[model samples]
Target: MLDQAWFSKVGFDWHPHRGFETVTLVVEGQLEHHDNAGGHGVLDPGDLQWVTAGSGVIHAELAYRRRPVQTLQLWVNLPRRKKMSQPRYQNLRAASAPLVEGPGSRVRIFAGDINGVHGPAELHHPVTVAHAHYEEGGSFTHEIPGDHNGFLYVVSGSVLVGPDRMPVENGHTAWFPPGEPGLTGIEVHATQATQLVFYSGLPIREPAFAYGPFVMNDRSGVAKAIEDYQSGKFGPIPTTHR
Candidate 1:
């Protein structure tokens, strides 16, 4: 949730988590991150970092302000079976992410494929993540898969989905039904520009039990996780900050 407003100070501190995956996408400047699993890196503009805190892990994200830092942090719930798996990480730079551009529009593929051009992000779930930009009167059609759930977060400007035309300004999100697949038109006035993030993921058919940073399947599982953390099983939190 780090935005353009808070670039002077570090946004988040070292925190422990279990049974979920965190995806950080840097749209503006840089984000430096380090974790208890011996993972550390920076996510620059157009870069993305995926952290799978399967069993348990502690991590922190600090905003690097050589330039303005604007990014999105998404927490995806993991399946029950993979919740106890080992922790992992994947960092993708801007140059490695795939892109598609037309007359007045451009698309950055962050997770899934668009017209057979897939992003470098490796996901355990079926997901499509993309950022799109459009000029005045420009439009692009996103062919969403019928099986996945899809949503759009407006970073700036206005868009038309189906027969409804709505203004999608910064910090707003929109969700769409799975079966409806058509041209999601984004039209900006000549004096305005538009940007939006699109994401779709396969639905987990299992129950979700969320508490603080922990997202598990059952109440007892959550209790056991807290006990494990307090018992020094995942190692004590690092004293030194990265």
Candidate 2:
């Protein structure tokens, strides 16, 4: 969560990345992104940006305004098979998400299918990502694929998770235990007006060597990525933002 008012004064400069993808969600204010691959976008609240640095790429992110901005950024590893594929980007606007509304709650499916509603972005990995908001006393149930690992993060307020009603407070995260080989229904009951993000993904079950912006399967891969980056193989530094 990038929320401090002082954060507006700081910004990420040009950097290199390889062997992974970045998923960024703007929760408040705005974010501007740019990459050497010619991809650029300005993300407003509820918008998402997905960048796949398949082989390599250089990019930067900066606050779009001089105000408090809250953003969530995730690094999704690419399988070894697709580590050196082609680089790509997806700028998913907020309205592209499919909205699901219940009694006192609503959800925006941003990166995967939910109850037949599909998200706008396509990726190499299988994952379900959603942002949801609930009024006090609101409740909802969703099914998760058993083979995927899942977690619920309370962005604000409080909520009870699962049949056990495990309490998850603001700024905290709750992990769901591994389940059987099928879909499992999970319930959420908001104890107060709350907001949260749900993320579930199929595990890679492979070794990972991470150093700064690079994520590879082994040390040799990381070294090679570093060498290539130093050799100007990750493309030139991106200087502009949209």
What Cα-based lDDT does every candidate model obtain?
0.74, 0.82
For model 2 the TM-score comes to: 0.93
Global CA lDDT of candidate 2, please? Answer: 0.82
**Which segments of candidate 2 are over 4 A away from where they belong?**
1-6, 239-242
Give the top-scoring candidate (lDDT): 2
Instruction: Give the lDDT of residue 226 in candidate 1.
Output: 93
Task: Report model 1's TM-score to 2 decimal places.
Answer: 0.87
In candidate 2, where is summed lDDT lowest over 10 consecutive residues? 1-10
**Highest TM-score, which number?**
2
Clashes of each: 0, 0
lDDT of 1 by residue, 1-242 (tens): 22333464676778888998888777777888888767778787778888888899888888764445777777888888889878888897767778887657788887876656688887777777887887876766676666667777777777665445655566676676665443333332212477877877777889999888888999988898899898978767888774
Question: Can you give the TM-score per candidate against the true fold?
Answer: 0.87, 0.93
> Candidate 1: lDDT of 191?
22
